[model samples]
Target: MIKAQGLRKTFTTRSRKGTQTVEAVRGVDLQVGKGEIFGVLGPNGAGKTTTIRMLATLIAPDAGQAVIADHDLLKEPAAVRRKLGYVSQAGGVEDIMSARAQIMMAARIHGVADPKRAADDVLKRFDLTEMADRPGRTLSGGQKRRVSIALGLVHDPPLLFLDEPTTGLDPQNRANLWDRIKQLRESGTSVLLSTHYLDEADVLCDRLVIVDHGQIVAEGTPAELKRGVSGDVITLRVDGLETAAETLKPFAREIRVDEDVLRVYVDDGEHTLPALLRTLEERGIRLSSIALDRCTLDDVFLAHTGRSLRDTGADA
Candidate 1:
């Protein structure tokens, strides 16, 4: 379980334009319930990782208050570390270290009663027993990732912090990791996952917060956030954008103009599409394309941020 308020972090970076102050996390408020998979969903530079790092005690927040697993974040960092497992985006593997060796070292660091038993148990759990003796460089991407997670779990902590855990894995590997994460929740381990993948967040998180520009724009269950969009989406590509938007206004709850698309939100898209088409015809609007789709998390994002998550480069 985790709770934090107004957590902030900033950095100075030197670019061609010279040194500039960057507020990676302006002020983020987060909460994760016990036995649940909570997600921080956002774009690449949206500060999800910065927030997670703060909560995991890997980085100190510029200003905020937090309690991770009942330990004060600022005052009891060591205690917090003992209560949580942190698997960073890097996969935390050494090229020369064997999977079994890495896990045993982790167990030993955590002071497990039996290091070999702990390592062996995790290797078997993650199905890495076959490659347990192989060095990290010899393992496949999926195997290396699974071994990283196994290392995190060797100590059997109650909470886990996963930062972009599946960023580079293939679909099969991502699915495998997802199943394992879901199992962790079922087994009563709380997880805080930071990801830019919409499908991953939608499928894995019990509740999630959407962040953009270093701020949380929305927070709710996936279904709840999608429901907040309040209607189906009808996307259209017409020659006369503004005129088409005006003509379709009465029939639409809202309209968002993208570069080549006009997304019209309406409660009755099927019925309204005909009227919209008729109105467009009367207005002499040349319709290039049209489509109807159920509202999605992306739509929710568009409503709150005036930009699609896809457009924001959240996809892998």
Candidate 2:
């Protein structure tokens, strides 16, 4: 439903030093298929929002070509807007307006044939019928979020843009929202999502692109990206970390040292553990803790960007 190439955006900020250009998004390319949830995963400052804004017609890219929902993004923005729904990062609903009223107004603005009925159906779909009459300010964060999504979906546009959909919700609410997003895909609404959460990208996205420093570093399905990082992850909490990592390099496919632990990637953790421990013992390394698990998105991010998403994103 969306295809973009060579998308770039820059901002000029005035400071004491003088005007400086900040390349917020540089050369981002994207392809989102119909009836699928495609994710743009990255850290806070990795241009995820900037890229989404460019595609949503809220901001024009400095240099790029994009077509969304079969309409040229730059040339046919109004037609593109008519076919898509955008829920910004800070989802908005008037504090004094009830959820039902807000959604109905949105539907009317979008020129839905039956605004009231459309709003009601969307409220029911998002399980917000019970509190539909409550003011936005009175609702919980999760409830407000649901209401915002319902408002965006009331017109039933073919495509949806969600920026950081579940950033602050609790686990239960997050899962609830996940089900709703899945239902949208099942019912054939193409979705474009942006998130920094590793697990969200892994569980929700059919395919994703990992962005860093204003550029896409890797792109693939979650499993494909994880599989690209060879071997299992063996994390060790040990003293004398630097020496131990260097000594175990021969047995490890890759090694990354965090603040309090060393994450070692090895072909076979079961067989490698004994030999690794012996080497540490012989080298007088003091072991505090150890864990072995399959490689995850963090490992993938590390492989591609030389940094862990766990350190940068708001992890669960």
Determine which window of 10 residues in candidate 1 has minimal summed lDDT: 307-316
Name every residue pair that clashes in candidate 1: none
After aligning candidate 1 to the native by TM-score, how far in Å is the CA of 53 from where it should be?
1.0
Off by over 4 Å in 2: none
lDDT of 1 at 54: 89
User: Would you give me the overall lDDT of model 1?
Assistant: 0.91
Model 2 per-residue lDDT tens digits across residues 1-316 = 9999999999999989899998999999999998999999988999999999999999999999999999999999999999999998789878999999999999999999999999989998988999999888999888888888887888888999999989889999898889888999999999999998888988999999999989999999998887788668999999888988899999988888877789998878899999999999998999999999988888888888777787775473
- Model 2 C-alpha RMSD vs. true structure (Å) is 1.6
Per-residue lDDT of candidate 1, residues 1-316 (tens digit): 8889999999999999999999999889988999999999998999988898888888999999999899999999999999999899998999998999999999999989999999998888888899999989999888888998998999999999899999889999999999999999998999999998989999999999999989999999999998788668999999978878888889877888987899999997888878888888888889899999888888888899888899887793
